[model samples]
Target: MTMTIGILTENVGVVGRFLACQLGIEYINTQPLINARPFKVAIAGSSHV
Candidate 1:
């Protein structure tokens, strides 16, 4: 059997990155790929309260 996993987050924190590293997975943004498909990253005015 084969399996795959994915983690999606707006902003990855220290713990998130650590987990990704421990799992040997890529922690990155999809901007580069989306750039070719008319997608973009949106910045918020402030962090959620």
Candidate 2:
């Protein structure tokens, strides 16, 4: 059997990214990972955030 890993995030942002690279898993969105899609590196909004 394979191990199951997970993460709890407020939104699709930087924290997810680091997880993607290190864990080699897909970064899911608002839904469960089973229904969610993979994510990539993208800069959104202004730097002022």
Candidate 3:
């Protein structure tokens, strides 16, 4: 059996890693696609408005 879980957050530094460790899962940092790009776009858009 195979299972997958994904957790999305603005910042996944310490807390995210800790949770993944406790859950016995591998922590993969997909920050650019998951958090960074959108955040940057939002910030840029807000600044422009």
Q: What TM-score against the true fold does each predicted structure earn?
A: 0.32, 0.29, 0.36
Residue-level lDDT tens digits of model 2 in 1-49: 0111233232345565554455555554455453333342222111123
Write candidate 3's Cα lDDT for 1-49 as tens digits.
Answer: 0112233334465655554465554655466467544443443444356
Compare the candidates by TM-score and give the number of the best one.
3
Error of 2 at 47 (Å): 33
TM-score (C-alpha, index-matched) for candidate 3: 0.36
Query: Residue-wise lDDT of candidate 1 within 1-49, one digit each (tens)?
Result: 0112122222344543454465554544345444322211211111111
For model 1, state the Cα shift of residue 44 in Å.
Answer: 27
Query: For model 3, how many clashes?
Result: 0
Q: Which model is ahead, 1 or 2, in terms of lDDT?
A: 2
Report lDDT per candidate. 0.32, 0.38, 0.46
Provide the lowest-lDDT 10-residue window in model 2. 40-49
Residue pairs with backbone atoms closer than 3 Å in model 1 (clashes): none
User: Ten consecutive residues with minimal summed lDDT in candidate 3?
Assistant: 1-10
